[model samples]
Target: MFKYFNPNKVFFITSKAPKYVLILFIIVFTIGLIESLILSPEDYKQSHSVRIMYVHVPAAWITLGIFSTITLFSVFGYIFKNPNFFLISKSLAPSGFIFNIIALVTGSIWGKPTWGTWWAWDARITSMLILALFYGIYLLAWRIYQTQDQAFKVTTIITILGIINIPIIKYSVDWWNTLHQPASINILSKSSIHESMLFPLIIMTAAFALFSLLIFLMKYNTELIKIKNKGLDRL
Candidate 1:
């Protein structure tokens, strides 16, 4: 599946994506916004501003998810010798970088009220910053190297090395004392949240997933056209 990710395949699918996904994204996202801002109960402890969780958590989740995907794409790019996989990884980075910024900024905003400070040099926060740095370097690696092959290898190596940070980001609260709170919606165990709050969160996450795909499809299509124009259709 990864190896066969060619221009024809990407363009064929992405060209039709809006026809299928955009309306649904808008509707679901709007509903989620209403639920989060108007209907969902505020935290008894944190009050109204807890609504930031709707944005912060989803952004953080997608950032981690996209990077994991980029790492897998990098692995398959090498194993299958497919440049299309590399392009897909490249296409994903810009959006992922933006989401990473959103997560950090929102986190700091949330932190200011909760922790009484805008920034803290704790375990999870530090590791997340490292993850952002890794992402930054991965994006720059593509431009710093002149040739496609060199850029691919350098970025791939960076992506692979960066995988170590993902687990640390996830488990940092457990490994050490941190200002950041532990996970509330655990998959391995029962979630600590109520259904009312969880429903909006789930809806928001789905909407984000849709929007992220929509963005990636557009970016992927752009890259496909670029490859075609460069006369590298065989890649």
Candidate 2:
């Protein structure tokens, strides 16, 4: 299906990305850290600890976002029989898993002070845990299947199946009464948060987006290198 296997296009995109994106990411991340940690006002309820939400919330958002992207690629690979699509999906799994873990860890840390417990069997937390488990299974598919094609097929199925959980996680708080807060940016109203808090939150979200893009680009480049070397080995 991928008739346009343009190595020159991929190389140009990958090589040109690092220079501009890296500088932008570093600058944004630094500004975001300062805004969130130093300038933001303390929460009325949780006080300073509420600042952690900047990191925790963004991590959670990115984790889900990455998984959704992977699922899309998996679908594309399955439908079009595209090896490049599968390769990109596989490369993305590691970063998705890492972000999922970060979200879980940071959520637990934030929960302890706010909820009086590190974790609960609440809908939100449980759904996030399920996401992590699916990531593990996706990785395992790669290791267990002997052939790359076989692994890609299996993992693609796994990824597509796991996507069902994304909506559940998103609506978990609303679906069932839970400790987790309801959606902040929604149709009902503007976010309940104040300007001081909102500014940092936006900064941090942008930083996470930039960081995810940077990492994805790097991983994609590595996979291209591996593919090139494999061709050499075959020759």
Candidate 3:
């Protein structure tokens, strides 16, 4: 459950990723843009607005994935007595929050044309809003607390407890009579989407994942520098 990793080891690994990762991201993301905008067929019902799925779905996926991973990292850090996980979680929280906002905003944009409203209190929407709240709190803990120990204690506990919402968020449309659509892609079963749509979805998801990694690494390196500075001050 716990992975004991040195903070410096993280910096070392991510430092090597910049040039290679960015180039690959650029290629894939450009292809993703073309696929979503020009190549993919318009939905008969939703029409062109259906294109929002490319960005909205990927953002939703990243929102859940990042939060769940942060919870796991928080748990491991607590169990292993490694603050590095907390630092990583701290770095990741902003990206997660950003994507959560994107998902909701884009969902609202898509909903206006399709569902006739900017917001709905469907199970999925409610849970996603809850997640955004927690993500805000998670980031605030790091900023508001004067000590890392205090911040970590609060954040680790909140993240571990709040992650319970992820499964609920994923399954909300299924469990409740909701306006939100059920997942088009199933991990256990084959995806329900056409190959054309699915291909772009995959590319966009990869591009987003790589983009997120770049963001996290930047924040992680900043945190490492701050920690180093603090250590020097103590000396």
Query: Scored by CA lDDT, what does every candidate get?
Result: 0.88, 0.85, 0.88
126-201 in candidate 3: lDDT tens per residue?
9999999999999888889988788888999999879999999988989999999888888899988888788888
Top lDDT prediction, candidate number: 1
- Which of 2 and 3 is ahead in TM-score? 3
C-alpha TM-score for every candidate: 0.95, 0.92, 0.94
Ranking by TM-score: 1, 3, 2
Compute the lDDT of residue 70 as modeled in candidate 2: 91
RMSD in order of candidates: 1.4, 2.3, 2.1
lDDT by residue (103-122, candidate 2, tens digit) is: 89998999999989999998
**Residues 1-235, model 1: lDDT tens digits:** 5534556766777788865788889999999999999999999999998999999998899999999999999888877778888888998888788888999999999999888999999999888889999999999998899799898889989998999899999999998999898999988988998888999998998888888887888888887788789887567
For model 1, the local distance difference test gives 0.88
How much lDDT does candidate 3 score?
A: 0.88
By TM-score, how accurate is candidate 2? 0.92
